[model samples]
Target: MTETSTVLRTGRKFDQVLKGAREVFMADGFEGASVDDIAKAANVSKATLYSYFPDKRLLFREVVQTECGRMSEQILSMVDETQPAREVLTVAAQQLAAFLISRFAQQIFRICVAERDRFPELGRAFYEAGPRNGCKQLMDYLEKAIAKGELQIDDVELAAEQFSELCKAKLWMEVAFGVRTSVEQAEIDVVAHSAVDMFMARYGV
Candidate 1:
């Protein structure tokens, strides 16, 4: 199904159903989550759930899109594009690192990869809402910084993408691979600061 045709309907309880689905999906994954369990968690009936989301895949797609949109909004609100590149990039890195280590990110990524063959739109939704959105935001900041002579970069898009990858340096792989189930604030800070330092080293004017 196409992205626009994914959801069947929306109502007052739409957010309620999504909340319950997100909780269940996070706990049990895509294949493991049950309609009964989701209905129970949402405090709604199966009929009510179906009215909002006719298919389980559609519900999952909605959850991914909603959560990723929320994260993107939060990131945009936290970072000021007018600030010095170091300060702006540090906040951005910290946010990116924290997002990378989140259970939501990990779970959604696994679900998309596992279900890609059957539901390619799921991966597209995740990428457009998550990484692609992030790069676009960062690219705007990089463009301003370049204009101010605070950074030297021929390719703002590449710099933005690199900055995101650099933010993932120490934490992303371990969290993604299940080697670490939890992460500490100190560790996140270390990765964020190191990413900023490295990014500046390569681009600072």
Candidate 2:
């Protein structure tokens, strides 16, 4: 089920609930987080939490969607769509690399994978809200670049996906696999710029 279809209601405290849910989910994960803890963290009564989100799954999904929206907006604000593919893509790749190595993103990804067998829909929802959404944003920007004769992409969707993977390269895998505790800015720049260079080599006109 989609994130929007799962929302039961909204009110003044909607954002407050979401903030609390996000914190708890990130800390305790989907299965470990409890309604009581979420309610306490939100400083809302159980009844109030239930009124806003009837199910824990709905709350978790909402948090995921909200976080994804924030990430997309952050990247968009950092990127200049009017710029050439090289410039715009360097910024985009840097942001993507930063996010891929982020603790929050890693935890959300792990949660989805860890619970996928029991709650397959959560995995789908996360994919649609997170990775797929990011690709769509990149696709839009790539289309604009194509129209401007800056890039010559045969398949915008595939190119977007490839660029994202290129950003991950060796850094994200190292972080995700627990081989690295943190990534330096230099490392991010190296990976991000290399990704941009590789992408432009393939797609730039």
Backbone clash total, candidate 2: 0
Cα lDDT of model 1 by residue, 66-141, tens digit: 8888888888898887788899889888888999889899889998898889878778878987899889988888
lDDT tens digits, residue span 17-111, model 2? 89889899989999999999999899889999988888888998888888888989999998877677799999988988999899989999999
- TM-score for each model: 0.92, 0.94
lDDT of 1 at 109: 93
Candidate 2: C-alpha RMSD after superposition = 1.9
Worst 10 residues of 2 by lDDT: 1-10
Model 1, which residues run further than 4 Å from truth?
1-10
Candidate 2 colliding pairs: none
